[model samples]
Target: MLHRIARATTAAGLMVSLLTSFSARAIASEPPAHCRDIAIPVSIAQGQPARYRVWGQLCTPEHRPAATVQVLVSGLNYSHLYWDFPFRSSQYSYVRQANRAGYGTFNLDRIGIGRSSHPASAEVTLESNAYTIHQVVAALRGGAIAGRAFGTVMLVGHSYGSEIAKLEASAYRDVDALVLTGNAHTVSVSAQQNLAQLGQPVGQVPRLAAEVPPGDNGYATVQDAQRPEFMYNVADADPRVIALDIATKETNTLGELSTIGDADAPGVTALLRLPILIADGADDKLACAPDATDCSSAATLAAAEQPFYPHSPVDAVVIPRAGHAINLHRNAEMAYCTIINWANRALGTPPPSK
Candidate 1:
């Protein structure tokens, strides 16, 4: 059974306000779980001065503590909302689904994004983000975040976020499993086109100007008009989702975009021995093109990515008709089920049906 929260007007308003304010902490009574806002102190690079806090929401099942926790990371121009979307959240929220499946989720805003510290854009890179995430993993294991040590930790990421996850898993090898979505070893022509036209300085965008610290010129955001093309398969997406996505869009760094592909180096993923799941939307033009991985089917995608993780068990899935932001598509639930079911099987933790 799905976990559903009562749709109260006041509750909805509170959620909107929290997001609008870009508060470091937000509390929502949705998903019918035990939820709390968290701030884990981290540094841009290991052994460097600790200067930032990675903010996130930690949600767990109501009846019992979760044995495994999934740490979620979103792509560029996205916040934690990519994993726990607000509109029609019952249907679109991966956090709700994971909680129902008996797994806790920590949805984080990467450094330089919403509610987190906004360092100079030039200071945020894939390696720095990975180092910060490594600290977050240690906090989870050491019972520092929510006062409960999670025995099993799974790192999950989307698009550029996936690149960070791959780097963290390879460099630290601390996570028990890794889930990569909206990503692949090859970059598509459409992806290059979309990326080329999407970025603009955040300060120039009126809506995002107040979200970041003043004088932080290193951040960039996608223009509202270009978001649909950059993130959605319009035919398979709802107009409302697109509108909300654009309205709530966050900033990413120039440093990140320049080094986003660093994780795709020849032997980066080869170092991971943990179970890995690779998933992407079937219609994800950003990952599927004539020269990119053949995302026509799950089998083909699995075959294409197999060489990258030669030493680990790898599973791949293609959500039909969905686009790059699969979680926001009408068929998002299918993608959620695919991920949860795969995690259950791969990790050998069968969630008791709610």
Candidate 2:
């Protein structure tokens, strides 16, 4: 999942013990396709039908059908590739770690980004994208994916994805729980700047200008050098990891960006009744505030969320020394472990230690 990168003053971080990963795998079956393609049919509020030939991959510890499944939605400008990062395979991949922990993880590209179909940026608004998420969850529950109906399904999202998941959970009440990462009620000016520098449209980039769609003016990509500045904690992130991100970068549409803040809009109910987790990096400059103020600690961030979810039980954690992309930091495992533990408890599955 892609998260809006925040400025961080210090760094040390993503983790993996090959053994810990192996032990987390509970099912005896071989892992399924590293990734697969599926087209999900969905109709928008306007009754317009469009097919999302989504790119997704699922992994579980056991061979039998998973009792609970986590449908992962990535943030803006990212695709399903965000979940199963190829760089560290074992080290930085949230998907690998989650499978080792025994819960099934299904990672998919959000509608207009990555391998999914792109209808003009105008068609990919927050509400439409939320509808896309709704259909994906329904498909999982109905056994359209991997042909194994899950007894329970949890929705996991990072940054923009988290916002989309929030909308779906609030409006449709279709999910059992939600794990929202790289998200907060507020955003920093630095974060906004990060969004601004994310390159011009496809036609504007030197190499892509000529062949791209006629009016693809709404999508943008991260500039090469700025890639780290936008998505990684430069002080400690692996150089190679940063390189892969820039080379494999995707596009973020203006429509999605303009409506992203609606993640907190009054359009949908604030989740005061659902079980939710608010996860952010201790050094996250963006979610903290415009000047990187506010989220000085995990407790502060959690407390900040209280007003928004007055009646909901909320628990928050801040990954130390990590920036916006906790999963990509050196201590990525800490982020992974925190989430897997929370998810296990929410889904009623045996903890990874068990």
Candidate 3:
């Protein structure tokens, strides 16, 4: 993996554009053949620091330019290039298409996941995560470290990261496009119900921001690795996803819970100010649970309830024979193609269709 750590010596002034330059050569430490690490502090009042991983090639136009910038934000417990990212899904085709179209691709793993800095006590709440993303945007836009400016950056987020993407799109004016995957309307599982489902005592489930041991509450153990197929079937169809999977653990239970309830409700799914695409697996447990029901239903509910943000155009779809990670499963390339097509049209650079 290739990575470089950068600290903001001066405050990233909001109005004045303070640009920092980082040449590709400066990124001396190559991220794993597939991963890179980046750190930038949050601008939030006393908010903890934020860090993320970058993946894929950042080839320039003369090389393989598709879209201007395509960023993939992984769900909790997953880091950049963590899994074997075999390009099996339609999503892969979309990435290739984006590259062909002139877009540089990147993915940022939120704090507490991946190689990013974990707060002294991991603060995995949605609000904090949203704040971290805000800092990331500021750093990226202000040229804090990598100093790369995206002409047309598209945000692709899955599971919990989808909520973060929504927050970023609604709160920041910088993002041009948005994609949300594995969305649930309201967690079908209430606090009590969630405990029962997890077979834990009531009130034992940690808060949205609490940190638990890798095996404390919501984790899949090494012993459970025997069924890698069942645990991560969605990643199997793609070598890239598999590679990514190998680098991550299922120890983000608190992070997932934090995305639910009043703690998670404040800023998540607020309003969309830009074009948005939402995709989900037909049978994702998070979307098809007792309260949520299914992926399509959850998408519709989220869109309908947040009617105030109607100015942003929206499209939703459900993938077949897939679970939570639609982009890593069967027909992965189709998923990517669909999203890229939507993004292209939104960015005013529609691809030539056959």
Candidate 4:
């Protein structure tokens, strides 16, 4: 795999973009205390590699890199904090749960979001972001940018991030397995209305000015008032968690917004031979409604998903009462355990005791 990456001639070979001395900024400047920022050179276009310092959190079972690693991708307008969730370390943290289960996780801020380089937002589309993800995978595989190597890699993504992961897997077929969450083929009306509220420029938002900066074009962040309904099931969510989520919201480019309908990934997912899992928050207003076609239970979710990945073993689960932002929900551990357990079985790792 490393050899193929090294020899690739067109927009493939990449290098670490941050200084040899990595910057140790926190994902949310709060206290989960296990993540840092690392930069990588992503080939955004042919001969156009740009330095992007993606922020990520790392957690391994025994304080060492695990044999298998999961590369986590957050959905639109989110950062690595989505997985680490500083709100309540005991309940809302997926990173801690995965770490305790003997799995290594590296969750990153997509190229144009978070502390990563703010490239011209117009240039960072789903397709280009997938390439950035591919480079991160290659860097991890060869121990180039991330400083470690794993025997296997599992790609895990939420919402829009799942789309990028699907594209990466389809184009490269480089990872061992995949896990997708808060996603589905059909876009929901509730989500569409919520998304429309974010039409204003990100730079105009008072809380996000420093993060969005002055030059990037075509990027927008959701209005603070619209976040709770758009991201979480209001009745089931903790008001505090939703507050922090809104405070730290990231930006998404017009490229991501405009090009997504053209990048529907069920067809690509169908071609994957790797183990597959599609887990959704059962009450997700944006992606998985209770009345959704086959979303009532895990069996239904699995049944509807089996056809998408014919060559791979497909599994699905609906985390009860949770919404689109599964990790931020009060019952987040259920979703985290679902993912960690599936990843264990899929990658042939020794299963964790239940």
Candidate 1 residue pairs in backbone clash? none
Clashes within 3 Å, all models in order:
0, 14, 44, 0
lDDT of 2 by residue, 1-354 (tens): 011011111111112332343443432233532334566766654466554455567676654445777888887766776778888666788887777666778888777766666767776778888888888788888988877677787888888888898888887788888888888876787678766765656765644333234677866666666667656667757877777766766777778878887768764545536667777877665775546536665556666665676555566667777777767777776777777766665567774443
In model 4, the Cα lDDT at residue 195 comes to 72
Q: Which ten contiguous residues of candidate 4 have the minimum total lDDT? A: 11-20
Tens-digit lDDT track for model 3 on 29-129?
Answer: 22212223455555332433323332233333343233366666776544554222544422443334444444556655565554454443235566666
For candidate 4, the lDDT comes to 0.72
Looking at model 2, residue 176 earns an lDDT score of: 85
Give the residue spans of candidate 1 off by over 4 A.
1-31
Any runs in candidate 3 off by more than 4 Å, and if so which?
A: 1-67, 82-97, 145-147, 190-247, 253-256, 259-270, 288-308, 352-354
Q: Each prediction's TM-score against the native?
A: 0.89, 0.85, 0.65, 0.84
lDDT of each: 0.82, 0.69, 0.49, 0.72
Candidate order, lDDT descending: 1, 4, 2, 3
The alpha-carbon lDDT assigned to residue 201 of candidate 2 equals 65
Poorly placed runs, candidate 4 (over 4 Å): 1-36, 63-65, 213-215, 290-292, 352-354
